[model samples]
Target chain A: MAILLDGKKTASELNETTRKRILKLKQCGIVPGLAVVIVGEDQASQRYVRNKHKLALKLGMNSVIKEVPASITEAQLLALITELNQDTTIQAILVQDPLPKHINEQRIMQSISSTKDVDGFTAVNVGQLYLNLTGNYPVACTPKGIMTLLEKYDIFLRGKKAVVIGRSAIVGKPMAALLVNAGASVSILHRYTTEIAEYTRDADLIISATGVLRLLGAEAVKPGAVIVDVGQNLDETGHLVGDVDFNAVKDKVAAITPVPGGVGPMTIATLMQQTVDLTEWGLANGK
Target chain B: MAILLDGKKTASELNETTRKRILKLKQCGIVPGLAVVIVGEDQASQRYVRNKHKLALKLGMNSVIKEVPASITEAQLLALITELNQDTTIQAILVQDPLPKHINEQRIMQSISSTKDVDGFTAVNVGQLYLNLTGNYPVACTPKGIMTLLEKYDIFLRGKKAVVIGRSAIVGKPMAALLVNAGASVSILHRYTTEIAEYTRDADLIISATGVLRLLGAEAVKPGAVIVDVGQNLDETGHLVGDVDFNAVKDKVAAITPVPGGVGPMTIATLMQQTVDLTEWGLANGK
Candidate 1:
């Protein structure tokens, strides 16, 4: 059996750490603040927003939820984000994904001031990450979560073979960059890739965020490979599953993360952590 | 026998194209200027300065060679570079490397302005290359040369496996970034890599720049691996050699570059092209 890479336990520890930091900052009359914007009240989006806001309050920070109508234009969305960007009280801004199709997602994403862009989707933030400049902006939550997990596990990335089985901007690209900067040899497989197995099968660590359930079987993974599955797909009975074929490949791997209890909790944990980070920076530096 | 990747033949074509561009700019009374700064009269530095000056003149651009004494402090070298950075007439600046032991190399390298950094050693240029930014800056010459070779042979980098057997700041790191940005799955191997063969043997393309003669043998490279030998080491008889065992691995590889005629000329060619680019951009945008 593979050793479970339990993210829930790790995330709890992180949340506790964040709570303590928030308490300390409060004594100095500083409150970490996060502003979350959601459009049209999509159920999934609402759930995420609720969890984030609830967690922020529990951690002793200020949280604001702004609900917008589905008819909101890109300009309006941009205006709201820009206002939050300049708001003295808000330390971090979160614009939840899945805005109405009429909205120009790209422009709206870019409109968020890079400093308050806790999501790390803006080109400016991407550029900073690309330059290995961690001076500004929070990195994407999931990738940052992965790095945190790696650091917690004492898994050194230097000179190790890392294969990321996706190329999405939010996760894969940033993840690969983080790995490369840490001195790992990174191989990213995307839609255009012909021989994905050739890269993945020999990797020291495999990170799959393709969101395709069971994309990696036993044959696709090398024995003793450390597998990190970022996928979250519903199984036939509506149970959450990951990109890895856990039944087939679990025993062969050295360490593997389970679906619901793995990367999911880490993502939310990083969000809270970055909110606090943005808050602290603002307090100290007054950004 | 493998086909040779001839840099002289390819660079000449590129230079011919650049020469035409220089003439177009000259018609408008705009002269492309390159300043070569040499601190300490090292024989190798003198040769490099002379070659660059000769090439600039041959391409109908203004070239100036500035020599400073060996005992020059880091601050003094930086002062000279700062002056060149502010000189609008000088389109590009090249500071010859391997400076005296007393000077801090990184500090001096970062002092050069990105716009005038024809050698592409400045932090901004490196940041652009690191981030794969949209704007143009002088890329390091060797990577540009390698790109020319790849384009010449119609070898596609997208979705291919590339193994770089070095990690130097000038060649290896930038080379890996270029490959990764172009969609190649790049793995940069260094002295600390435990399983170099496991990575190199599976690569579709392999680039070696360690400057250690015969560092890669038949066992290190698989059959049909396109090898770009950026290494240039002099044999006991003063003949130029490369990292690859050319005699032993030539028959096994699909293509390879000869040491002297392969990457050498391409560096100068790229320098000339960047000088012209700098000139054109300055004339058009007043950079």
Candidate 2:
């Protein structure tokens, strides 16, 4: 049987570390703050924001949720982001995705200050990640969390043949960057790929972010390969599932992250962890 | 026998277009300006800068070569860059690589304004390329030139398996990003890579940027694979050569770029092309 990369359990452990770091910062008269700005009433976005807020509070940090109207102009949102950028208390800032159609999403994402860019969506931070520069910089939470989990399991990344099955700015691109920085030879596959299995079958590690259900099965993957399913999909029967066919590939794979208990929890935990990290990094630079 | 992907001929064609663009700009009362900042008296660096200056002038653009002593401090160098950045006449800025050991290179590279970042080394521009954002942004020249050459030869990138050897910020990293953005499955290999052939043998396109001479030969590559060599190394006999054994692989491959006549000329030509592009983009944005 494949070793379950229990993300839920791992996230709890990470949250504990974050909680302690927050305590340390508080003792020094510093409270790490996170500001999550959400435009429109996206239930999913709201739910995610609320969870983050609750977790921040639980970890002894200040968290603020900025709920804006769907009619908010791009300039107005940019002004708001400017304010957040200058706010000394807010060490980390994140604008929820899926802004109204009128607002330019790329412009808003790039407007966040590189230092307080909590979600690490800014081009500057993305560039730093891509270059693999040795410095303190926030990365996309999901990919960062995945790296943390991989490290926790003592996974060897250097010189490995890995395949990242997506090209998303949020997940796949950053994930591939992280893997490459860890010295893995990575191939990023997307919708245009002719034969996904041609790459995946020989891959020692496969990270699938494509929201396709049952994208990989036991027969498609190499035996003993490690799998990380970043997909959050719903089966026909309404069961939450990942990109990998867990039941079919479980016994054949070396390790696999279960959808519900895996990447999702770690992502939230990493966000809180990075919030404190940003605070510490700020303090180190005497901000 | 494989066809030669003649970058020298392609670059000349591109230079013609760039010259025409410069004429158009001049008629409109605008002169595309290029600033090549070189530090120290390194012969090779000086020669490269001279070539750039000569080319910029020959192409009908304003060219400035700023040379400083090796003893200059980072602050002093930055101050010079500040002046160039503010100079309305200057549209593109390139700080030559291999700055003196005392200088912190990354800071200097980052300080270049993204709009005038001709070499596209800044984190913002790299991020833009990595994210495949649609807008006016400069990219690293060698890779951009390689892309242009591939397009000139009508080489299809989408769905092709490409292996980019090396991960240097100047070449390998940006090259891989370009290939990925163009819809090719790109695997980046570096020193830590265990088996270079493991990826290269099956690749439809191979871009070798590793400075290792004769790194790829006939036996290791797939039949009829397209090869783009970015290496400029001296062989054991002190003859200019590329990473590939061109003679050995020429007949077996579908197309190949020769050592001296391939990537080198394209790189310089692309730099001139991008300088004009930056000027046009800046004007459109009312800069």
Candidate 3:
């Protein structure tokens, strides 16, 4: 059987480090604060936000959720973001996805201050990531978390062949940038990519974020390949699953991350860690 | 046996369109203006700036060269950019690269206003390009010119396997992003990459921007593959050459671009077109 890259265990270790860092900041009279703005009542978004709030409080940080009605105008949303930008106590600001249809999502994202953009969805942060700019800047949580996992596992990426089976701005694109910046030859496959196996079969590392159940199988992956499944889907039996057919490919691969216990926990852990990072950066820069 | 994707002919066509647009803007009492800022007395930089000035005037646009001393401090250079940013008549601003070692290049790039960043090195513009933002932001001239070439030739990118060699921010990275955004399976190879032929041999379209002489030879390319050479190197015989071995690969490929007349001329043409675009955008937005 392949070695399991346990996300739950890794996330717990990281959360412990974050807790200590939060304590140090508290002793220095700086409480890390995160504000999550949600428009309308999205059950999934609500669950995600609640989990984040719970974790932030557990870590001794301040967390608040600003719930706005679906009827909020774009102007009102912009004003709210501007207010959050000026709020001295709020070190990190995240406007949850799936805002009301009328609100221009990109414009709302642009309104968030880049420094406090904990989600790292702003154009400035995205651009800096692509430019490989040095110094401190928040990165997209999912990809940043994946990098942490790769580092912890001591997977050297230099000159490796990495195939990313998605092209989303959130996960796939940023993940490819990170891998390429780390000296890996990166290929991005998307909906328009024909014969995806032709690329994946030769990959040293395969990352699937396509959200399709069992999209990656044993036949598509080379033996001894490291697999990271970023997909969360419902199987035919209503069980939570990932993009990879983990059971079928586990014995053939060198290492693999399980669906529920893999990348999911790392996302929340990264959010908490970035919240503290943003707060510390804000303190150092006197913002 | 292969077709020559003539850059000089295509660039001339684009230049004519840009000239007509400039005349239309001029009749509307708006003259497209570009300011090329250079530091020190580098012969290559001087020649490049001179060519740009000649092209701008030929297209009936206002162009100026602001030559600063090499000893200028970062603050002084930034102040000059600030002045240019506030100048109403200047619609596009370009800072020639290879500033003195003392000046931080990234800081200097960030100093230019995004609206007038004709070279598209600014963080906002680079970010917009990666995000595939719509509307009127300038793109890096070389990549934009390459895209124009692809479009003019009616080479559809959808579902194609494209390989881009080199990862410099100016050309390789942005070019890969553009191809990925256009629905091509894109791979980026750099100095760290091992056995580049392993990827290029299967590519439907190969774009080489590495400054190495004849990097993509007959052995590395497959039969009937389309090649675009973005490299400009001086051969041992004192003649300009590109990354591809043109003579060797000429009959083996479906189409190819030559060195001096391929990507080079398109750079200046795209810069002129962006100048007109920036002026029209400014008029529409009342900037």
DockQ of structure 1: 0.27
Q: TM-scores across all candidates?
A: 0.87, 0.94, 0.96
Note the Cα lDDT for every prediction shown. Answer: 0.84, 0.93, 0.91
For each candidate, the DockQ is: 0.27, 0.77, 0.83
Per-prediction interface RMSD? 3.9, 0.9, 0.7
Each prediction's fraction of true contacts recovered: 0.24, 0.81, 0.79
Q: Among these predicted structures, which one has the highest lDDT?
A: 2
Worst 10 residues of 1 chain A by lDDT: A127-136
Q: Which regions of candidate 3 fall more than 4 Å away from where they truly are?
A: none
Question: Which number leads on TM-score?
Answer: 3
A-chain TM-score, model 3 = 0.97
Candidates ranked by lDDT: 2, 3, 1
- Candidate 3: residue B195 Cα off by (Å): 1.7
Report the poorest 10 consecutive residues by lDDT, candidate 1 chain B: B123-132
**Model 2 misplaced stretches (Cα beyond 4 Å):** A69-76, A86-89, A284-287, B285-287
lDDT of 2 by residue, A1-287 (tens): 99999999999999999999899889999999999999999888889899999999999999989999999999999999999999998999989888899998999998898889877888889999998877999999999999999999999999999999999888989998999899998888998888898889998999999999999887779998999999999999999999999999999999999989999999999999989988999999999
Candidate 2 pairs with clashing backbones: none
Which tens-of-lDDT digit does each residue in A1-287 have in candidate 3?
98888888899999999999999999999899999999999998999899899999999999989999999999999999999999988999999998888988989988899999997888889889998998899889999999898888888899999999999878988899999899999999999998899998999999999988888888999999999999999999999999999998999999888888889889889999999999988888886
Candidate 2 clash total? 0
